[model samples]
Target chain A: MPATSGHAARPEASGPTGEPFLEVDRASVQYGSTKVLSELSLGVMRGEFVALLGSSGCGKTTLLRTIAGFMMPTSGSIRVGGRDVTRQPPDRRGMALVFQSYALWPHMTVARNIGYGLKLRGKPRQEIAARVAEMQALLGLEGLGERKPAELSGGQRQRVALGRALAISPDILLLDEPLSNLDARIRLTVRHEISALQKRLGITAIHVTHDREEAMVMADRIVILNAGRIAQIGTPQEVYNRPSSSFVAAFMGAENVVPLLVEAGGERLRIAAGPVNRAAAIPAEGRRLGGRVVEARFRSEAAELHSATAFPKEKATEDALVLDGVVMQASYPGGVWRHVVKIGEATIVVDSSHAFASGEAVSVKVPAEALFLFDATDCKEGEEELR
Target chain B: MSVLAETAAPARAAAWYWIPRAVLFGLLAFIIFGPLVNLLLWTVTEKWYFPHALPLEYGFSYWGRVFSPRGNAMGSLGTSALVACLTVFLSLLLAIPAGYALARLRLPFRSLILLALLVPNAFPNLPIYVNIARLFYQIGLNGTILGVVLVHTTHGLVYAVWIATAAFGAIEPELEEAARSSGASAFRAFRDVMLPLAAPGLMASAIFVFLESLDEFTGTFFVGAPDVTTLPLLLYTSAAGGNYQIASITALILLVPSIAFMFVVERFLRADVLANIGR
Candidate 1:
């Protein structure tokens, strides 16, 4: 893939071996003049669950629609199992999509809804019934086949939708936020069940989701999208721990941002002090720093808060960075106490087990391993981006 | 004692709260049904006098007169039924496709087409029908069932298209997407999903067209007079000639379907579909 495409290199574990089961090569979808999706390319390995993760209107759904052949791309081609299917209609693409709304036929019973595809294929009634029963059994909807979609609970309705899609046994499965409709508790269980089902069936699936943790829990590889382009694609752990950009870091819950000036010297990258962050010389190994000024980020839980006068100066800032701030407010969210600390003109959240007075002076220390650095100028910070 | 007084006072207030509503409802019922009761009384009246508030004698003699072989009421009713049915068929044949496009597709000048449908309903029908009848006369179609049916269809299409659009629009587009992704062709998806979901609304629209065509008078008069007379035309002639009994029976017959079908339309045109009207 070209570097300009904003795509991540294929993970080493799932490297390009032979051919991808579904390959979206240079797919560009445009609605009139506005480009909803730019020249996007993706290669999904057979039996791999890849999630297209992004905020709303970030083109994740657009990409899924294009892949499903519902919305044809203005440019580029889509290939499945090494065959060009860009011009084919959704029905001929041999991929089934489970819609977010479930989209069950209100007029039909659950059995008919699941067996509709098979019936359309001219399958015998007995065969269709047999397949419908099998899918119902797999999705834990065996006794609900006689019920209409409206009569089923939200979770059960979701399973009926899944059963309907899986009944066709297509080459690929596309899930468009199938669990987002369920209540929070139900969403958790359904998430696990879908992941287990995908693994058990060894089905190649592409899931679109705006929920970060949903993608983390359900997908093997997450394709992070931003502004109609691929920001990064990697395993959930990789993207969370080693995000390629500041936007990814912020999106992945490292929202507390402070600027830093850095110096690259042979084997070590030195982070100089600014208005908030202290000067720290850390190992540059495995760090992809390009510019002298960088944005330093650390999650709330990763930073340790201590009283300004009690903090150990001898610990040194050689490998760790510290910020001097005052505690603005504190709240207990279950296990830990979270505090909003005012550092210079900005506010950063810090979580510490030890209680601190609201107005007390404190210093937040983030170790080198926890601190994420990115080119400062590359991520333009604006007033509206404070969150 | 205080608690008892509070409970009793609220109970009394709540019980009397419905008094005004009941009176208003009674007034509305009277306004709607008073004329019908008079028409019904006339239909059965065997004899009456100028000084009598009610009929002096009551029987089904006029109904027999209207239904008998000598009466033209039955013949005119048959013509009306045929014309209304044809009007429904023609209106729906055009409306269904037009509605689907208006509801689902991004057709160019969509608002223009939707607005143009209102033009048939915008002006007084008498003048339009006069000009239309003149055109039909030139084409040798005046005084024929086909010409009246055509005129009724034009009137019925207004309701047919608008309501059908609302009905089809009320369906979730994702249902069709779900169908297509399940290996169904676009046409099959529409047949198996979109059509079934929109069926109730379309039925309601059809009923509206059917009822509108059935009760149509002015258009039928201008286009089908002297030959293809409908129930409304028959009613007009009897009422004008002071045969109140025959006219009342004819009106009661025309009203039967309207009353029956409005109930069905109420049941099928769901609140959501009703809310989506014109939008």
Candidate 2:
């Protein structure tokens, strides 16, 4: 990894205020012999919503908890506004966490749950009450002050959890998949509400979630973690369109893995003729392609389906991957017709407007822009460990 | 199935269901209230012969005699109440922290430690108390209120520690973490979230210790015989002296508080409160 990625992996991304408010300087966490979180360095700017995106056991939660001061980082320090707080307790750290389960005090009403932090700080009774009311109104929890957590619906409980986190007015808000408990229909509404609320308050937030779309829709920058190390950290556009590694490409919905043999080049790489794919050349002036054997991944919607009988030999020279295959099955999933195409021994999914019969031979043409290629030898070790 | 249900189900269900239910209800009512009725009769009976089915004379005079300041009954009741309270206090003081550790920490010998808590009850308590009394006698703790309280605490702690551990175990650990992230110190988090969540269970445990101490006779007699006069000890003496009325009144006194504690526990440990917290 480069020094820039080791220190600040984000590619020139800036928050609304253009200032780094929270800095996790090489924080690492270990559980006995196994390292759950390797040295992870990230600088979250002020008023920015940074999402740590990963699947389960990817150390995203550990990173969030370490930032929240619940877990101690084994080596590095965490800083907020240039103040070292690695040794501080969760209470002393200026961060409030909205737990996945909401974790509302069952003995207390919504009003008290929101006001609990204020009470702990020994704020004046009227001030705490006023702040609690304001938070409730901000989160649209009006007329639910006296209701216990059990009485509230899932969405309402989620808002109450958000309101409680906001009431403290901490420097950073830490969210641990708070919307995961909500139904899919309600999750969308809460997602937008949380994003808008964070922007409206201009408070920095670090959200931990495994939901790719949720992270894309809510965060200013997505920090994709894999195997306790940061695989990629960039804006949603950057990570989705220009992933750093094959692991990230597969994680970001590019599940169709196609192996290819390419010769390294400056402007255009010559894709060698293989058993599954034809020889072609793709633009590569800016891309960091290497090695003879390359792994190519494309999303279901990224590839085009066509008839294989009409072989366009001249199209191979263009900036696109042409794979010959036969359609195995097709399904209408809402608008697009999804087809399962068998390209030799490997099967891949491609979505097109028109449906192809099961036995019909097809061609999958993945454009260079939509196709993610990484060196097979460089990422083969990580590929087998992937879920 | 349809033929059986249509033809034979109703009569069989009625007979079998109602008959057993009625029998169980009768048995439960008798088992629960039968002793209380007998105690009531004994409290009011002024005079009775061996052959008499009921008390020949019933009056409120025994109640009056029981409440009299000069009567050992009132003083013994007070002593029993104090001893029970002290026992509960001491037992919980040890149980709460120990229970929290047992429930939350990943200790090496968790099951072994839990088994050790039951050690005081595992063996015959009579011989244990006899040895305890002998040790106390040498240490000058025998025949004092402290001696009786210490003795009762040994018994009280068995239930207290186990219940407290279970109570803490029943609460979600996330509640404490939530409190901590909400700007509460570790102690404050336990006091605010963990303690409140586990209160009902701990309350039930405390009530168990209280009742155990109030009715404790063997340990109390062995450790505090000459100086301490708890209601149970007083009842024993009164019964042995052939004063059946005083003994019955003392038992009644003991029963009132036990019933009251049960009611309190029921109200505190209502299902709705636990069902909704952090789920």
Clashes of each: 0, 0
Candidate 1 lDDT tens digits, B129-228: 9999999999999998899889988888888888888888998999999999999997898888888888898899889888988898899899999898
Model 1 lDDT per residue over A1-387, tens place: 342124453346443345678888888999889999888888888998999999999999999999999898988888988899999999999999999999999999999999999999999999999999999889889788889999999999999999999999988999999988999999999999999999999999999999999999999888899999888888888788888888888889999888777756557777666666666778775777766667888899999998897556444387788888999999999899999999988899999997799999998988888889887765445212322
TM-score per candidate, in order? 0.93, 0.91
lDDT per residue as tens, model 2, A1-387: 231244233545533434467888778899888899888888888888999999999999999999998788889888889899999998988899999999888999999999999999999999998999899878888899999999999899888988888898999999999999999999999899999999999999999999999999999988999989888888898889888788898999999988887765878988876667877888885667656667889999998998986556554647888998889999998899999999867899999999999989887888989988888855664333321
Provide the lDDT at B44 for model 2.
Answer: 93
Off by over 4 Å in 1: A1-10, A307-316, A378-387, B1-31
**Candidate 1 CAPRI assessment class:** high
How well is each residue in B58-117 modelled by candidate 2, as lDDT tens digits?
898989988998888878888998999999999999999988888888788888888877
How high is the TM-score of chain A in model 1?
0.94
Q: Given the true complex, what DockQ would model 1 score? A: 0.83
Q: Give fnat for candidate 1.
A: 0.93
